[model samples]
Target: MSEWLSVCVAISLLLSLVTATAAYMLYSGLIAHINVLTGSPPIKKITFAYKFRQGLYRNCGQLFRESHNIGPKLPCIGVFYDDPNEVPGPQCRYVVGSILSEGEKDADKELQKRYEASGFQVFSFPEVTHVVTCWFPNRTFFSSLLGVRRVYPRLARYIKERRLCAHPFLEIYREGRIHFMGPLARQGDFYVPEVRRAERRLSEEDELHSDSDVSGVDSNSEYSSGSGVLLSDSRETSPADSWVHSPPQQDGGDRGSRRRSSGEVSFKELDWEQSGGQQQQQQQEGTEVEPRPEPSQKSPEAPTQEWWGVSGEE
Candidate 1:
């Protein structure tokens, strides 16, 4: 009788422990969800350093790692630009990096410069309004996974229910919490210039590809007329004229096949950009660009800025 009683007590304790643990997790999650629903993320005017990347969001872990390794405990942020369900993983765009300052508590100028030297782009967003925000605890890596899984669905539902035009979702991790924010206004402001240009160029390329497909035009036959030139309506347009070079398609050639994105800067490209940037700064140093006359310039307009395999036509 005593043995049976002891076994029963042990089983009851085990059940109680399991029940308490489960309830604690559930309660924590429930509280976070409720707070997120009612909370407003504080996205004040701030300076940030970020590296933009075009790839799967899952792959953005590397960016986070790099940022954290560089500036541990600094507020880190991830900006996602597409829904995986709607956009292909390969086409998704994102930027991840650390915040340099918020109002006061400014970071060291040298620190900011260091980050920039390491291929991170720096920008400041003025105080913006109509921002939708929420936060989740990030005590562990698992918290990030949990926060993403729980928060996004609620955010989507909330936006859908209210018919809000929030865009370019942001996840800001600071002081063991992740604040999710999406701005209803100035949504375009968050997209860096490179990303904007990339999107525009990509759309143009997609249109061109679709037209070729619809017209059943042989890509090979047209380019054969000239080296890296496309003959359209008796006009020869060299690929070199564009911001990005679209080399003539060679038989089974992988060289010049893949394009480099803003985030994926190569060592050679970095050296070239350093040289180019120095030259550009020198050209405009002590010169007034804001007061330039429209339609008539004393000197020829600075060569249209060209970059990464894309036309600089503006």
Candidate 2:
């Protein structure tokens, strides 16, 4: 009976050792894969004050959104060290990060500065698939063995909540220009709120000026059309008026010439009246009239020769 009990105990101990070794190997493999994929070392420490600052920025973003109808508050991730009790109060470090949307990535420099001043760190993953939080120290084999269970479940929960695909977090430690947080950390000399307001005012003023210009162009077009109609009317009446005002000159012994001239003048008057009536109809109907082609010099000379020939016959 004693021998059977010893064998059972040894078998149980062997199984336990094998399970622990397998877990440790799995944890190491995951860390190695993460490091290769992210191209950066994982952040293991961050300060509590840093997180406090992020909270303030998050509130600011919320308030700004409420007042301006701009954007929702940024989501953040907090990475905690395993043993908070071992670290000193101020020096205790942990990472705080926010995921940026596609649009927010190109936000104005001043706006980014405001966010940075509020104590938020920014990071962008080339292919962001999962949210990462450091629950265990990477250097410790035992901690990693225990942490994988909690870490993976939390990661899975985060992905489920956000409705994201299976993804891993890249470890980011410090601020850099290449990193998304770099832009936010940068400072600007100008006041962001005032500048934004001034830009809005300028835009409004430009819109008003453009509207006035469009109105002026419309009025000018109307005035031009009105003047054109008046000019056309005057042109149609001028020839008839000149003919009526002038008396035909009669030469002695030129009765045939006088008769021919009178006949030509009567024909011209009839033609003019018909043309004027057509123009009036067109104007009243608000339709454009095709312009009459001008008589060539040769045409006028032929008529003058006919008049001379009539005078010679007389």
Candidate 3:
């Protein structure tokens, strides 16, 4: 009985040890698996997010650069009208207000030039109403197009307010055209550089001219005759004799109109009429004059005797 009891006790002890070992192994495996999953739960997700964001930033930056390069040159040229599926018929192909035709005497050539410069090929599909072809290599083309629209805020707003989308180039045509409406590409060197330099030089010259005029006035005031005298006093103090020699003040408009010589007088008849009246007056005075008189004879004798108040009698 003692041996059997001991055997049973030993068997129970072995079973307990095996159960504990199994439980420990299962718990350890579960902990390791949980730790493996939870330790860096978002590592893959974060990496993917970073890559996506980086790609987006790169694409956006590229688009901005391209937009700036082409904006000024394109000048908001586009096809007008809606209805994505509608194909534009040749007869329906009325060109709208595109910068392409602006300042270009030749319509077809100007249109062609704009496309070529943009690195885009012109594609006219008979099926599509208007497949406004833009030179786009892959999706970059779309991005650039979008950027082009965003480049000129004022122009874009004007277009939208007027629904220029209905007729892309028409408004511009009616408005007498737009030059490089936005940014310019490298081809700008053909005209922009020289034009800008000329404008800057003209502005500088204008400033210099203005400064020179101001300085000239100041110098004249400092050294010109009549300096340090009041304007009123200068005129009042001039000698009366000096008037014959002094030039009339320029401020009084033309002096020639103020005075005319007798030769320039048109009324010779009026002068003759006045002379006749004077002659009549002189004749009337002669008739009124009495004889100097015998009084002259009497008074003359008295004066001769009195030559010396001492008296000729004395």
Candidate 4:
């Protein structure tokens, strides 16, 4: 009988512990899910000490811990620069730090200097008219996780429904709440300098790759500015070569059209052709049409169908 009683007691204790843990989780989620607001948040600006990092955002908890250890009881802020759904986990960018000043309040210059001396960067969010704001309960350590899991989805939905261009999500842990903020205006102001530098580096790399790729093209051929016309690089001296006629890519494009060949058709208009090629432009149907002057009695020396002009005589 005593053995059975002990077994019952053990089972009861296990059930009680499970119930308590479940209850606590539900309570934490409930606390984090409240006070969901999406609009202009009541903040003009914020000054913060930050450490920029690039990688999975889920790993940002370590950053929070580090900031907290250095500046306990201080408000911490996280600026997330990429959507995990759109960007790769390893490529996500974020800056985490402690807030020294916000709005009209005086900054803790000593704390700012301390963080700066510790190799942390000092940065500020510019004043914005509107922002998406929400808060999650920070009653316990688990609250941060719950808040992130709960608030971010709803915040994303709200922004999508309203078509608000909120970006570079900001999370501020202060006063027992994890305040979520994203600017609807001046959204670019939130990106840290590190992010800009990284982006510039990426763009420069892309440009360099494009340059290398373009350099290996056909040695004799080159692409035109527009009109997608393939200009043949034929430079053989023919009877019609001297009277080179190349039309502008567009109807109202530059009146002077240079031939794709080497130093051929360099002149804007030949002596026999009207200035600016206005007469030929009206007769052309498509974008590119070489205009050739008709034979007339006034110029008996006019080149025939072969257009045997200066190059022909030579």
> Candidate 1: where is the Cα deviation over 4 Å?
1-31, 36-41, 104-106, 206-314
- Model 3, span 1-314: residue lDDT tens: 99999999999999999998766544433122111010111101000000001111113333223323443343332221111112111211111112333221333665455445755333221111221111211122232222222222223333334322111111111122221121111111111122223334533543454445633232111111110101010011121111001121211111011122233233544565666676678778884433221110000000000000000000
Residue 95 local lDDT, model 1? 77
Winner on lDDT (3 vs 4): 4
Distance from true location, Cα of 283 in model 2, Å: 94
Sliding window of 10 residues with minimal summed lDDT for model 1: 302-311
Question: What TM-score does each of the candidates earn?
Answer: 0.58, 0.21, 0.15, 0.66
Between prediction 2 and prediction 4, the one with superior lDDT is 4
lDDT of each: 0.53, 0.28, 0.24, 0.53
Better of 1 and 2 by TM-score: 1
Worst 10 residues of 2 by lDDT: 305-314
Alpha-carbon RMSD to native, per candidate: 18.3, 37.5, 43.0, 21.5
Stretches > 4 Å off in candidate 3: 1-68, 71-74, 84-98, 103-118, 121-314
- Which portions of model 4 show Cα errors greater than 4 Å? 30-32, 211-314
What lDDT score goes with residue 8 in model 3?
100
Candidate 2 structure quality by residue, lDDT tens digits, 1-314 = 99999999999999999999887766544444321121222321221112221111112223322322221343333322111122122322223344334323454455445556665434332322222233333433333333333343343343335433211122221221111110000111111222223334533543454445633232111101000000000111121110000122221111011112455446657777888899889989999988653211110100100000000000
Give the Å shift of residue 7 in candidate 1. Answer: 10
Candidate 2 vs candidate 3, TM-score winner: 2
Q: Candidate 2 — which pairs collide?
A: 45-93, 46-93, 46-94, 47-93, 47-94, 129-167
By lDDT, the better pick of 2 and 3 is 2
